[model samples]
Target chain A: MTVNVSVTVNGMRHEISGVEPRLLLSDFLRDTLGLTGTHVGCEHGVCGACTVLMDGHSVRSCLTLAVQANGSEITTVEGLGTPETLNVLQTQFREHHGLQCGFCTPGMLMTGEDLLRKYPLATDEEIREGLSGNLCRCTGYQNIVAAIRSAAALRRENA
Target chain B: MKPARFEYVAPASVDAAVETLLAANGEGKLLAGGQSLLPLLNFRMARPAVLVDLNGIKELSFIELRGESVVIGALTRHREIEHSPLIASRLPVMSAAMRHVAHLAIRNRGTIGGSLSHADPAAELPMMAMFYAARLTVQGPAGRRTIAAKDFFVDALTNCLEPEEIVVEIEFPIPQHDGWVFEEVARRFGDFALASIAVSIRRGQSGIEDARVAAMGVADTPLRLEDVERRLCEIEIDVRMPDRFCEWVRSSVSPNSDLHASGEYRKHLLGELARRALKTALAAKGDRR
Candidate 1:
């Protein structure tokens, strides 16, 4: 049966009707809303490629049903920054060459945003642990760790 | 992968949820957090005709101390337990095990009740629940009833709850032990443990007064090593105690081989992890003294 889903995405409210109860949040974001920046990898949720912010907390979109997010506020990769101006974490990712294929970049950026906002992230080990759910095979996670570490330092400096 | 088409209902109260499940006639699956259930749905391993969404039941999401017990609502998320100052101060072993649960993203949306209900043999929460001797309260069409953790888990990925029943909350008695430790070895930091151990010890004037030992990923279900606990209390605390306990633990469980690790390897891990956990708990007790 189709269900009505109303959600606020990146501060913009979208009311979608006739959404299948089985539609995943990942598909809803990508196909329905045209926010393809949120990548879907390993739809079983082992890969963090579908990570997004649900009410300021990072959650696996693939594991979340679209109907489940009816009243929630979601933040996808598209919400982070634009081509003209990148957010701090996005800038650090670009500088450190965090993405080799860019398939896992969106998930990494979203998870990084969640970590930078909440954690002290004083150590590289902490950043690595925070990024454990999101896998990156191309760079072997060295540059991703570097980028997040840099962003964490910048956050500390600004605070 | 996507789930098969199913009807969805968001019930606002426990009564409503129970009623929905009853009306579905065992075809309804309770959805909490959606961390474990969603994965099952995505794989189409579980095809329930009705998905009863319990997230709207705000009353089921809570962590509070009532009387001598720390009662945690079934809907309480792992991340909430991880960051709770109350859990840190009271059930410190649980606080420590939270890190070994899934990654931060999964933990944020995963509920303790869902984890316990999922009853994954390798998952950390089931092991913790057994370690704490938690009691689960389940509500059905008949009414609410309580089940001890030992009796609650029937098998891997299975609980004793009837299809129409839902776990309302888990009540853990505040431990009065002198020391506690949770040790796990996962291939990756956030992966399911190969074999993990949890130990809690209470010291008396003479020696170890009481000991609680449990292990995961080594059997059909999370196991409480009563024989090992008895042996631990019988032996004197020394450097060799871990070695002795390791041998006891190795002999206690017959783990099955899987792609992650062999049964023999898991047995070895159970031994070593038990040794390390026991030693750490003893040392913590020593420091307290």
Candidate 2:
């Protein structure tokens, strides 16, 4: 059956109709909306590659049905700053070499953003703990943790 | 892997949700947090014909106090419970266990009622609920009924709930235990527990007033340490008292051998965990929550 959904995506409201009831929010963002920044690595929820913001809280878009996201606010990795003007987290990721193959970069950035905004990430262990949900095959989590550490410091100074 | 094609409805009210569940009969699944159910659906492990979403039922998203019990709605998310001041003040053991349920994202969408109803053998909340003397309220076409935590869970991924019954609320009795402790050992952070111990102790001026213990992951269902609890309550607690009860705790549980851990190993771990948790609880007498 078709499920109609209207979601405010990345600040822009998209009134889309005829979505399948089983269509994952990640698939909708990638295939339907052509905003492919949200990756679907495991399809299952184990890998955090599908992380996105639902009402400003990070949720697994792959596990979330598009119909369930109806009338909700969603923020994918694309919602952050563009390549020319990278967001602070994105810039820190680049500076710390947080990506080798980059399959998990989007999820890492999204989770890092949520952690920076909501938590007092004071130590490397705390940043690593905040990032436990997201999985990175490359970089061994050391660089990703380093990037989040840098972003947390920058966030503090700017605050 | 994608979920099977199914009709989805988000009922705006609890009564409507219960009605929808009745209409779908045994083929309906209630979607509360969607953290666990969605994974099961995607793997095709659960193929419900219809999903009755409870997200729109705002009334099922509250945490309130009634007398000495904390009444939590069916849709109360784990993240909310973990950070709730009421839960922190009243049932800190459950709150402490919520951190080990999953990471932030999973906990953000996972619900207490959903987790308890899902009834995974390795989950934290179910065992903690049993240890804390909680009750689960379920509403069906017939009417609403409350089930004690001891009788609610039946087996792994199964409960005593009827097919058409929707779990509406969980009432956790705020026991004035002097100290409480929930310690779990997972393969990795946020993974299901291999074997965990939850302990609650109340010490009077003379001796140990009361004690409760429960375990998870080692058995097909969450288990209460009736023998261990009884043995411990009979004696005056000391630093050496908890370690002496280790043998009773190990013998009381019948753990099954699995790929992750052997039954013998689980027994050994449970004994150690019991000793540690008991000692910690005894040491932190009259601790908050």
Candidate 3:
């Protein structure tokens, strides 16, 4: 059966029609909407490559059904600041060398964005806990944590 | 990991959800936060004909202390429960267990009712409910009813919940004895626990007054050691007695071997962790005043 779900992605409302019951949010964003920035790795919810923001909260899009997300606001990696005006987190990630293969970058960015908004003054340990779900095997989490800490510091200075 | 095609129903009320389930002829699955069910769908472990998304029903997402018992709505997410001050005061063990759930992102999307209904032998909240004798409230077309934790969990990945019914809320009694201890062995930080135990005991002047010991990942479902609790009540709280209690715990549990840990190792750790937890709980009991 086909279902129509109105999803607001990256500050734009796209009334997607004829969405399949089995269409995962990750597939919906990448295939239907052509938002290829959200990669799909380890579709089993482990690798965190399919992570995105549903109502401003980070969730595994691979596990979420497209129909269930009707009328909900979604924020993918594309929603964050662009290359010309990079968000503090994106800049810090680049500076700290947080990505090698960049397979897990989008998930890490969305999770970091949510964590910084929720916990602007998060400690190093809290930051580690915040990013626990987003796995970065390439960096061994050292540079990822550094990036989040740096972004948090910049956010604090701006605030 | 696309899920199989299924009909989706966004029910607006609990009663409406029950109606939807009844209409599906028990071939529907209630989607609360979808932390566990979503994964099951992706893996094709569960393929219900209908998916009743309960996110629209806001009534089932509350956490409030109603008198002596702390009542938590079925849709309450793990993160909210972990951060709730009411649960912190009434049921600290649940808060403690919530900390060890999947992870921050998973916890943010996982609901308590969903976890209990999933009934994984390794999950912490089921063992916590068993240890505390929490009551589960179920709602259906007929009416609302409550079931004890011991009676709620029937088997691995199963509950006593009727197919047409939904768990509306869970009530955990605030223990007069605040002394509590939780210990678990997990391969990774956020992975399923290999063996876990939740122990709580109250001490009188002469001996152990009231005690509860519950273990998970050692059986098909979480096992509440009622016989062991009775045996423990007979002994006086001391450093050496815990080792003896450990022996009783070992004899009482019938653990099964799995890839996570062998049955022998689980039994051994059960004794060790139970002993340490009992000692720690007893010590914490003395310091409560």
Candidate 4:
């Protein structure tokens, strides 16, 4: 069966109809809406590669049914900032080598972005704890923690 | 991993949800924070003919303290409970335990009611609820009814909840104990526990006034080992007794062996955890309690 769900994706609202109950939010965002920046890995909810902001909270898009997101606001990696105007977290990720393969980068950025916003001056341990859910096979989490710390410091100085 | 095709209903009210569920009989599944349900759907492990999405029912998503018990709305996400100051203070075991569930991403979308209804034997929330004697409130075509934690969990991946019934909230009684411990052993962080234990002890001038030990991943459901607790009664609240109790606990539970670990290994670890957790709970008292 089909359902009508009006989801505000990346600040742009869309009144979607006939969406399958089985359609994952990650699939809808990437395949349907063409928001391909949000990657999908470990659809069983282990990997945070599919992480996105659902009403400002980091949720695994793959594990979330698109219908479950009815009337909710979502922010994808594409919403963070473009190459022309990079967000502080994005800058920090690249500058501090927070990513290597870049597959887990979007999830890392979104998780780190949400974390730093909540804790602009978070300690090294807090940053690590905050991003523990997002896994990066290449970076070993050392550089990711460093990048998040650096982003936090940058946000703090600007504040 | 597409789910089986089914009818979808996004109900705005609890009564409407109940009606929708009744119309489908036992063929419907209530969708809360879809962390667990969606995965089951993706894997095709659970394919309901109709999914009653409860996200539209905003009233069933809250964490409030009612007298001694913290009434957690069924739709309340695990992330909310993890950060809630009320749950942190009143039922710190739940807050502390929730962190060990899958991770931040799963917790952000996983609901307390969902986890409880899923009834994964290794889940932290179910064991914590069993230890605290949390009351599960359900709304169905028959009206509302409350079930004690013991009665709620019928078996692994099963509960007493009826077809048309929806779990609305879980009420955890304020633990009277001045001491508590939540411990688990997993192969990696965020993985399901091979075996876990949550213990609460209340000490008085008369010695040990109250003690409760609920173990997970050892049986079909989270079990409150009353026999072990009974053996611990009248014994002095000290280092030696807990060790002895652990030895007794080793013989009590018959845990199943799976890919994570062997049943014998789980029994061995259960003894060690019981001893270690009891000691830690005793030491962690006075300041937090």
Candidate 5:
């Protein structure tokens, strides 16, 4: 049976009906909403490629049913930046060459945004630990760590 | 992967939730944070006819300090416990073990009650609950009842709750032990532990007053090493104690062989991890003195 789900995605309120209870938030965002910036990797919770912010906290979009996010505010990769202007974390990812294949970039960016907002990110070790859930097969994670570290530094400097 | 078709119901109250489950009649599955359940659903490992979403029951999400116990609603998320200053000061061992639970995102959504109900032998919360001797309050058609952590676990990925019963809250008595430690070894930082050990020690004028040792990922369920604890209380707290405990731990558990590690490797880990945890806990006791 289909369920009615209303959610605010990237500050835009979406009231959708006939959403399958089995539909994943990842699929709902990508297919239904046409926000393909949020990529789906391992459908299981392990791969962080489908990570998104639900009410400002990172959650596995693939693991979350679309109906579960009914009344919540969600922020996908599309919410972060545009082709004309990039957010601080997105710019850092580009400058540091954090993406080799770009498959894991969206998840990495979302998770990075969550970490930067909440954690101290005082050390590279702390950054690595925070990024443990998200996996990157390329770049050996050195560049991703560099990107997040730089973004965290910028956040500290601005504060 | 996608879950098989299932009807969904989000009940606003615990009584309503119970009634929904009763109506499903053993075919309904309670959906908590969905950290673990969703994965199982996507894999089609669990195909319940109905999914009872419990997130709407706001009353089941709380963390309160009551007298000498910490009463945590079953829906309390792991991230909440990890950052709770009260948990940090009162149940430091549990706070320390929280980091070993999945990653930050999973922790944000994974509920303590869900973790205990899912009951993966390698997961950290089950071991912590068993270590603390926590009491779980559950509600069913017959009404609310309490179950000790020891009796709650029936086997791996299994709990003693009847199909219609739902966990309401868990009560952890703040331990009086002066020192405690939780050590785990996983292939990756957020992977399921290969084997882990937890130790809490109390010192007396004589030597050791009491001790509790528990091990996970080395048995069918999280184990309380009573024999090891008894031996620890009998022995003098000294250089040789860890070694003695290590040997005893090595012989105590019967771990399964999986793709992750051999039973022998898990046993080895239990021994070494136990030794390290015991030594660290003893040093913490010395610092307290």
Candidate 6:
């Protein structure tokens, strides 16, 4: 009925005990760990609102079981940066108006991080395809693409 | 949504997994990527008494080029295959299909073994398995046995796999295809295709040595159009071959008109998409030569 999971989330090592085998990683982060940045939109894997990095690979936390993530590393949206200091992607998004209602911003930011790390994001087409998994009903995605593009360029420039 | 409470076991080895699965006596469900299975559980479509977690069985997670085929462990992730240079140089068609499986996030976690076992009628992997004439190796309490891809799929979200058996590896022959292409018609990118077709031709000195044509989302499972392949092999390669191939394809399929597209429309598109897919495959084959 209950399972134990020892996971390193956002560089903090925590041993969570008595976790239900059915607990979703999304709920575990938001409810159990008190890290509510990870949103759950469609419960099904469609909307990428609950995206998180498990061992550096982006996965749908809503689709991932909390017990399944035992002995793994997870990075949620809260791991990226704090309100006082925004990360490079957050800054770019703010400057480019990536979020309007902000319901999909957390997912958008985490997906952006993974894309920036893995892909070149050379063209708008590439950026659009990379972000296809995550949807934002607001802002029309034109600015999201722009923000990721700018962030990609800035990353390249700095490198 | 949360999955209903179920017993869980993390087996560290194949023998252990098989033993645990055997103990469940067909009441157990193996969790590989959990991409497809987890969704089903959350929706309450499937409620297995035991969840045989196979992630800890790291042995079933490698890609190796064997003598004449690429031997892939059942736990190998789609993302690994998508980015694999060996798959690129050896099993190129698989690389092409990987981009369409799901978003990068899902692909990063979804496994080919799980996909094949799940056997979604519209899924790309099952279609690929049929296209490649893949051979699956399954391990059970009795012993290990191999099943052809064509015989593995039974119907929508169903397979010939016994509950006690787990798919261990898949063997895809290195195609010496003269031309090959995987084409699908999805409303949006990454969505389950309404209808998809994959074509490959193996030509000899005099004429066609071999031809393989397969389609997905038009029937209970991925259909390998044998009639289309034989006719294509018999005819002279030309612009008209596409039209001729379409006739064969349209006649062969048994499509169900779902909310997405009418069965009539699917049958109609079968001709056109199959034609284009065959043409593109032929062109690709010619380019390589």
How many residue pairs clash per model? 0, 1, 0, 0, 0, 3
- A best-first ranking of the candidates according to their TM-score comes to 5, 1, 2, 6, 4, 3
Which candidate, 4 or 5, would have the higher TM-score against the true structure? 5
CAPRI-style class, candidate 2: medium
Select the stronger candidate by TM-score from 1 and 3: 1
Q: Candidate 6 lDDT, tens digit per residue, B1-289?
A: 3788789999998888999988988889999999998888999889999999999888899999999999999999998998899987777677777788878899889998999999998999899899888999999888999999989998898999887889999999987876777777887778888888887788676556688888988998988888777877787776787788888899998798899999999988877888887777766663220
DockQ of each: 0.80, 0.71, 0.55, 0.61, 0.79, 0.74
Cα lDDT of model 3 by residue, B1-289, tens digit: 3687789888899999999999999789999878877778888888999999998888999988788888889999887887888877777777777767887678778888999998998998888889888999999888999999999989998999888889999998888775788788777666788888888777889888888889988998899999998988897666688898889889988788887789999999988988888778877752211
C-alpha RMSD for every candidate: 1.8, 1.7, 2.7, 2.4, 1.8, 2.0
Candidate 6 true-interface contact recovery: 0.70
lDDT of each: 0.90, 0.86, 0.85, 0.84, 0.92, 0.88
Error of 3 at B158 (Å): 1.5
Q: Mind giving the per-residue lDDT tens digits that candidate 6 earns over A1-159?
A: 798999999999989999988899999999999999999999889989999999999999998999989999999988999889999999999999989999898899988999998889999988987888998899889999999999999999999
Which prediction has more favorable lDDT, 3 or 5? 5
Clashing pairs in 6: B178-B285, B179-B285, B257-B263
Top lDDT model: 5
> What tens digits encode model 5's per-residue C-alpha lDDT throughout B1-289?
2999999999999899999999998899999999999988999999999999999999999999999999999999999998898998888888889988989899999999999999999999999899999999999999999999999999999999998999999999998888888888999887889998888888898777888888899887899888988988887777998999999999888888999999999999889988888888877752210
lDDT of 5 by residue, A121-143 (tens): 99998999899999999889999
Summarize candidate 1's per-residue lDDT along A36-93 as a digit string, tens digits: 9999999999989999999999999999999889999999989998999999989999
Q: What DockQ was computed for model 3?
A: 0.55
* Predicted candidate 4 versus true structure: per-residue lDDT over A1-159, tens digit per residue: 677779998899989898887889999998878999999988877778989999998888988888778889999999999899998888888889888899999898888777766554457766766776787899889998988888878777887
- CA lDDT for candidate 6: 0.88
DockQ of 2: 0.71
Cα deviation of B144 in candidate 3 (Å)?
2.4
Q: State the weakest 10-residue window (summed lDDT) of model 6 chain B.
A: B280-289
Sort every candidate by lDDT, greatest first: 5, 1, 6, 2, 3, 4
Q: Return the candidate ranking by DockQ, descending.
A: 1, 5, 6, 2, 4, 3
